[model samples]
Target: MELVVNSPLQNQIVGGEEIVSNTSRNFIEANTKQVTLEHLRKDCIIPVFAKDNESTISHYQFVQKTREIAQDLFPEFQVAEPDIRISHLIKGRIPSAIGKPAKELLEHEKTLYYERCAFVMEIPEVVENVNGNNLALTIGGVRAYNQENLFSKKSPEKFKVFIGFKNMVCTNLCISTDGLANQIKVTDVDQLSFAVEGLLQQYDREHHLGLMERMSRYLITEEQFAHFVGKLRMYQFMDKSEQKKLFPVSLNDGQINTVVKNYYSCPNFKRSDDGSINLWKLYNLFTEANKSSYIDNNFERSVNAYELTNNLVNSLQSGARNWFLHN
Candidate 1:
């Protein structure tokens, strides 16, 4: 596996049918507005009360802390600017605003804090070629309204962080178990920074790349692909306990439908002439479909995509009881 340092890959992966070049962009992300790190730090309002403390981690602070720790940990690589997507505005009048109430005023006049935000920062200098596409080192975070009560300004704020690869061809993020922390519980910046530092420091890049490399060698025929898709759609309605045993992939019905569609029509990652798809392409399709997810579910699904693919490869190699593959 030859890694091209300083590859032409940039801020986004080349998505859909765009010319597959060194620099690729991503497919459009659903319900997200792309903003710079500076925009979030300077323009976004923080959420807190006058007399009490905050349980919420501001979008800007989360991104900044994660980015800073990542840079400090990987001193050899140059960190690019953070690519942030935010949605679900919490709009209201600021205590200092003098005119009318924010809702009464124009939409632009409100002091707003984003209730949901996700971002990816790539270290372009560290890169490798997988199958034919290039992947760069990428780190990202998700701040969403979830069961974790991520939006509450209480104690024990939670954030989802991941370290992985960004497909140069499109916005597909490649995350593995060694690189993802499903939830980081912290009360302040120091705790958050410590968590990020630990994850980056301990990430197994070689093992992660090995997992992806193994997938490229395995193939699933069209018949198996169809059966697998049908079973997955049904698995969602089954009991939760059953899903944990048979198919634990973290994709929604909408994301699965996108996989079915892309299997037939996607230019870069679709099936082959023999109507068979390799696991590598199959994995990328899951990630491509994941683009339709809102800010909150984005990272969770991305992390799941890689683990699912790696697990599938393990199933093929070891003959495990993964009905998602054999059945």
Candidate 2:
């Protein structure tokens, strides 16, 4: 995917970088002044709230809030309708005999309990790129089911927000990070704007222009890319002396080898004319491989892939920045 270098907000610094250095205590103290929902909505944040006289909100309400928030945030950008997924935990004994009547088994089960809900929205053509490719990011808010299933708890239901970038060319989210930090939880409904602002601030601090500048200027040799791959493998698979187990455990060595072989054989593995690969290309390979290696249908597997890719990209970018600054 190509990098987006000309975003309107590229030059503007919405929040100062120094805020990140302050302790959480100090940061909260400084931002503790009551912020109204109107002000937050102006910042493109739609705070979720229970319906009148109700303590909890329905799944439909959560998804509608996400759609509202995305529309407010990127009016020009194409916002896909939010997809809501609910996971249910079935607690029941397995049928004693094979091919037992499915309906009868369900009758014996006590209940299907709610596990969690994820409200996901796709923002297309957002102005951020990796390796010259246009990238889109997904914003999702998740709420877990509890006893009240509503706002019965004293503290507000903290929706865990995920902000991830998608490769426009490949339509893959393997390289997307959670803005700055992973798993940002929104505890105060009123302070949603501040929470998002803080996340963006942290991202700017960590992924400031210096990193991009270095990527634009430097390229790594094939050997260097190989070394990086080794580092990445160690970072992800190493577990105290052995590689971690691969999914769908039935796969033999030859099957695993074929998957790895095919991945490296892809066109993304090629180097540029300078006899060195651009950091973006190298990073993209990892993300592509991450997407291919995991079981795509499983949400947990997808999340793991995203996290792994995010960490690898962050680490590689940091290393590149250091290499350029010193060398």
lDDT of 2 at 129: 57
Question: What number of clashing residue pairs does each candidate have, in the order they appear?
Answer: 8, 7
Over 4 Å off, model 1: 1-24, 49-56, 96-109, 145-153
**lDDT for each of the candidates?**
0.76, 0.42
Q: Give each model a TM-score.
A: 0.84, 0.48
Tens digits of per-residue lDDT for model 1, 128-204: 98888899999988876444443344667778888999998887888887798867888788998898888888999
What's the CA error at residue 125 for candidate 1, in Å? Answer: 0.6
Q: Encode model 2's per-residue lDDT on 1-327: one tens digit a residue.
A: 111221222121133131112222110121112121222223221112344343344344445555666677667888875544333322323335235543454433222222344545668665465556666566655555442334333344444554565555654443223353333344444355455445533443235223433443446665665564444444454464444432112222333343345345645445665556655554444344343231212223334444443344455656743221122
Residue 285 miss distance in model 2 (angstroms):
2.5
Name the top TM-score candidate. Answer: 1
